[model samples]
Target: MPERKPPRAAPLVLDVNSGYDELNLGRLALISGQKTVPPGLRRWQKTILTPDGRPVVITCTVPDDQVVPHGLDNDFMVGLVNLCFEAGLPDGPFTVSAYGLLKASGFPDSAQYYRALEESIVRLNKANYTIDEGWFMHGPHSWTTQSFAQVNYLSYVRSRSGVRGTSVITVQLAPPIMESLRAGYIKPLDLNFYRSLSQPLVRAVYRQLDALHFDESTADGLVRELSAPLMAWGSRLGILSDRPDNVARTLKPAHDELRARGYVAEVELTGRGRDKLLRYVFGPPPVGEYPELALLLSARGVKSGVAVRLSTVFPERIEEAARRFDHYLKISSRPVANPGGLLVAMVQRPEDFAELPGYAAADARPGPPPAETPAKGTGKGRSARQRPAAQDELDALEAREEAKLAALQGQALVDWVLKQLTLLGTMKHFTLPERSQLAELVLHGQLDGRTVVREATRAIAGGAPAVLAVVEDVRRHLQVTHP
Candidate 1:
């Protein structure tokens, strides 16, 4: 056999499900940042005010068998969530190799990290959470009460050989969490930037801060500043100390690191003693320093040096190609195995993609065209005589905007179904002709996509050829109903 190639490096973006972010925000999960848990602290309660100003309480219970998860556990959770996304966010139990998890999470494959990973998994499996109110349900865009364990069940094996460690880990994420994630309640995190931080405390703080800063509804107007009382902020972070001075001292290192890294423009502590309030101005490192092309390229796992070189050498061409690449990344059902290579190819031969559906001149252009300049003699931009004419134009504009939005939503649904099929291993079974036929059926609503995917996964798990079985079953159903 010829020499085998190494596995491709997965993208470093983590679509951090909002439910996890809320849990972290409310202090219901990812316990105190200290290296060691405080003795005899099995239970804790924290209350945070909702955006509407109503206060909600969160009660956390740590079982006697496991210690509260903290520090490195935060990194482990990030890794685990990325694994779930990589597996197409399975509806049931999914298995991941231990080595894959570590590398994805930026952990070294050593006995020390392995032991830490094992310990973190045990703690997560045993912890329980109850939120009396303010559990944001992403599916319905509403807040409600909930109680859950982060992990329903977990099983793993330990491998003695360090290099060839192929230990598998199986986990079932709780329904509430998975439902929210599937419902599109997630924000992208720069896992690469996150791993670059020096301290665990800093990483934890950055994740929490990022969750607060990113607003899905209004992408452009991100929350740029945050202020909280010193004591309360410390408590929210699960800092071990209660004293103000000690808390500030413990946090100083993290604050300094964040400032140096450009995640924070400034960190200020105002007032004195118990009255002090901490304030931070959010400053993402890439904001002013890197050009848009460089930022976009690096965010997708391209090396900084290459991204900078391409952006600087061919500013306009690279930007256009990058946007085209991004459109595919969003709409393609399968993850891009080699994003950099594909992007370079597109940049090299932009004309090859001219006929591609996603590379349309109008669609590739960011945002809608600027509104027509106001007609003369009308303060509101149209005279009384021109009302009908201008009204017709306005209606046309609105119709075009709505059409664009509907097309995007339709593409999103198709992508979702295709992703599910890929996860079930059904897509790989189809020949090119069958694949095209199935795609047509899926697009035309002839296929119950979710049910098919679910059943296909079950069939494959039971050692059956799921694709062939599904086809035969469909044929039988059609004959029974039509005959």
Candidate 2:
């Protein structure tokens, strides 16, 4: 018998800090990249990436005609990360079971699900990734630079009747990667929660969110707030963009998906122009029945970091604001100017909160008092002479609120313009330059948001390229016709 070779010794080991290796970008995992395959025969051909704040070059290649394993495939790869730790993060041909893969993946035990697992394994074997940096040097098994895909090898029965359950697979880890795993080159993650998500982008987003700690650290050591420049954040997540609004449009659904399912507590977007800030407020990981107002709370806020601070100090007050505020947005016919600040105010003074969403009549704001017809030509005879002093006070209060109501409408209109433009921008219609000008108009009050939005909607019919011309035309038209 031939002498058996010992598992290769890793000269370089991975640890938390090394995760910040120039190539890895200080993230526990590279959460963003092209996760899914495009529909046709075109290869996933993004040849290079130079990230901001210190460019780190990453070279990518996927064999032509091979589907660049969908985002969902990553769930299994993450499972392998956890498995590596459990198996002592060794370097070699380690074996894992078909049953275990399916179970950890949260996929059904049905035959179809088994096939899906088989498919992901195949895809992983096919895709390749390379990181360029000195600290990220090559290992013995690699030719010169080791492909991330080079470290993996999987084999399993693919036919439906080939195996009933608990089939085994041999996984080989790169020597350097094994060393990194042993050195704790990983972040704590909610594996089960990650597997539960249906969308790949949402899953990837969750990893980014879960991996990041925020300003308000809880008593239990959980992170609840995150503040980062939108562009930096998108870059960290590997979003292919220099624009925050463009990035936001792609990540918005992930935020919504997380909020809808209650994994995220709240989220807010605020700041000036293209260099905007994004704040994500997290909640206790969903363990029981979720509150119905979670989405409303997540959606409502400005300077949300402050609002989250209030929630951290007084947790119950957040729900109170959400329950009442949701009612207000739905029925008040006006959007609150600064929902984040209002929530903090409500927490301090609880009495200001409105009724729940469905109770419109009970919660509606009072309007101005009814007018009297000059007392049948006797102008001097005050019709309100018989009315109570309380009515006069109420009328005054209603007038002040009426002005705020117009402010609310204006804010709502602006929000609509931003939302529409960002969405169209994602479709390639709204350019960064066009977005910059529109944002300036918004900041300067140079254009009516409602008008710009209507023009934008009309222009979108042709294609994204037409958006700029339309917006410019709208601006000129507004200056000449409406100014």
Candidate 3:
């Protein structure tokens, strides 16, 4: 058989300080544009044995700096010896060369230093830190010019003799994965959006109560207390009526159902009613109104009639009641005002009226006879109390309802605007060219175009879009064969 060329010498592995420079050398050599590796040097290929006796191939460039001078500095010689030893050829017939001066400096023979260096090299190679620095001259003149010269060290040894092949496995945890691993998960609420909707609703209700001659402080207090549950109820039922009359009409059934179900009792114009009204005017309520309220009120039963009476006797109590009732009417007028003055009567104690002695008996007496007014001819000094302008009252009520509707429409528009801005913001993070292509695709109905447009319009109208963009995107991107 023809003599097979002795398996090419194993490629050199160099350990160097300047990783960037070494990497640049390899890159420049490939392009053949610059002399990163010194002149006269060329790449070579070789094979080594795996631990399991399989052959592994490697390729590397040979550099001039590997030749150590005969009498190099002890430290430099030690380093070279260590490098060769690490290549699995510690006891050499291994060639050593260096730049002119280093070769002239005497080599050191410190067994301890040599041993420690060898151990370190073994550890470094095991850690996969071996790197090659292209060859260059190794002399004081060369060092000053290039700072540090590169050296390539190759080894040839019996099969299965040294460190073998290694495979690295990497696992990357994406943001969602990391977040899922956390102890507790929560989505942050947009408080600014919450407040923007809430503040106006509260203020509008307060103004309405003020128009009805209710005390401001009392109206504010009542509105604040009921706002939360009311909004929750509205959200649940998806009730977004603009006019108070329509709101009342829409919610009356829900209120009646809750009352009939015994989840809520005495659906009076009290705290519970006020809260429901506030939520209706502002935002969507909770999923199921009765169940949620039942959970809240189960622990605390309704206030006693006696307690209600005592509270009403105080002028402050009457003012508070008026304020609460007015606010409810402004937002939703389902719980009508107490027409028979029952709330006022409940506040008065028998003893307080006893001071008047005959007051109770007089109140119990038969109704008073009708009073006679002066005829046109009599011309009495006093005139009858003028009736209110029905037209004017109706106009005022209509204006108030229109304002509320406008606010709802405005909020819907704002929400749509925010959604559009979010989509644009997402697109901005893409690479320039990619973003341009995506924009074009959006225009051509190939991206999130229709879906985004639909969502935007739905947000503004508080209604579903006529065209479903997500469905359209699915049809375009993932063609499906219909049965």
Candidate 4:
């Protein structure tokens, strides 16, 4: 008999904290359908001085300077992000079908559309980034980091192909891109509604709103439903200007439609003179303000005063408790006899969240696919949506880092990083996080791949009693022995 594998290390269980709504799992790009294809080699660069005066610079380049990608690419990237999370960050070439891409993106399957897919791939591959003095986590140890850390996406295009061919493309994600998806700093989006919205600006506005964080308390100690501060143009959409006159023209249309749809409790575009901005608030879901909380109660058939006490006595613990509940569900293979009672206990005992089966000890048992997912963007390759209102802060942060990278001359540094990662992945069993630590070492051209790998292998096998200790040993060895 074939040796039974331990059930393929059941895929990691995801709760609200690690899955679904907690993250806006997509790449950043303009949702607006820009008809103009950038003609030649296109490049963008920006630089910023942090409050502490550390300079961060970014630079990016794309093929055919005039035909920069817009919503089409954004739609394609969002589909990839979704795949990474759903597949538990599998070592890629994530497979996608051509028909699926067309359906998700609303592109008609035709020769013209096929060409569109071909161009998007070229635009993506030509895209590159460099950042000097980067801020985002480049690695667990530290290095010269590449701005476009995500691997360039790969796909196949053939002449006169539509919905008839194999309809499959394999996507391989870079270390940085995969890590960002795994990070919880994301928000939820309803892609179904996104596909239905025909207007590009509407999709743009939707991504903006969906990205706002849910803070129960204001900076002034005032409690409120939700609030977000957004810029009118510029980086938010990667187009137009934030100038006084340019702020309202295109945005007004999106603004009106958004409020009319009841997605925003309040979305107002108001700013004095050249400082145009938007303040958006969220409305409750259909069942009420806190649908997840409410449903859990209704399931347990709790008493009427329970909600009031929980809010009054332990208002602070509610959100964290809910997160814990989710984490609990992720680890526990069995159902709880009393979920409501368990939630209440969590509220009273918030510290217990850490004790739940988590990163170091999470059950990787495979489970069914997420229930009721929206169709994948246009077969294996395209997407179209008015977009959702959720904005990913991580995306925003990467944008900042990428912008700075684009402004700097750092190709040698970018190449060194690519080499280290390529070698490590090929030769070592280091986890993603572990690889990140090793990545930082590449910053100043410290150690060659062979040396680093030898150190890691030696430290891991050399009597370290635990994983954390082994990691620490590697870190120590790099600092003292290597450099």
The residue-by-residue lDDT of candidate 2 on 37-154, one tens digit each, is 4545222222222221233444445576566555656666665554444343443454444555565555666887777777677767776756544123234532233447633666
Q: Write the per-residue lDDT of candidate 4 for residues 1-483, one digit (tens) a residue.
A: 001112111111111121122222232332323334345526655453322334556566655453555556655555555544544455545433343344334556576765666555556555766666543332473323446623366654343543222233445665565554444334445666665566665776566445433221223111223322234234445444546555556566776787787776776666576565656666653232344554454344333234333343333355656666777777889988877668766665454445665633233354663444346654322212312222456578678865654442222232223232232233233433334334334433444533443444444444534434544555675657445
At residue 112, candidate 1 shows an lDDT of 82
Worst 10 residues of 1 by lDDT: 1-10
Clashes of each: 0, 3, 28, 72
Better-scoring candidate (lDDT), 3 or 4: 4
Measured with C-alpha atoms, the lDDT of residue 416 in candidate 3 is: 24
Model 4 gets an lDDT of 0.46
C-alpha-based local distance difference test score of model 3? 0.28
Worst 10 residues of 3 by lDDT: 163-172
**What lDDT is reached at residue 74 by model 1?**
78
Q: What is the TM-score of each candidate against the true structure?
A: 0.57, 0.44, 0.13, 0.50
For each candidate, the alpha-carbon lDDT, in order, equals: 0.62, 0.51, 0.28, 0.46
Candidates 1 and 3 compared by lDDT, better number: 1
- Tens digits of per-residue lDDT, candidate 3, 1-483, equal 001112112222223221101111211111111112243434333332221223333333323433111111112322332333222321112222121112111223244433333332222122111122222222343211111122222221111332111100001112221221121111111122222222222212222221121111341212222222343333222234434445555555544543453323434332544344432221221112123322222122212222222232132233333333334345553654542233233222232323432222333444663464766666542233222365578789888855653343221322222223223222222233332233334334354543554444454444333233432433444333211
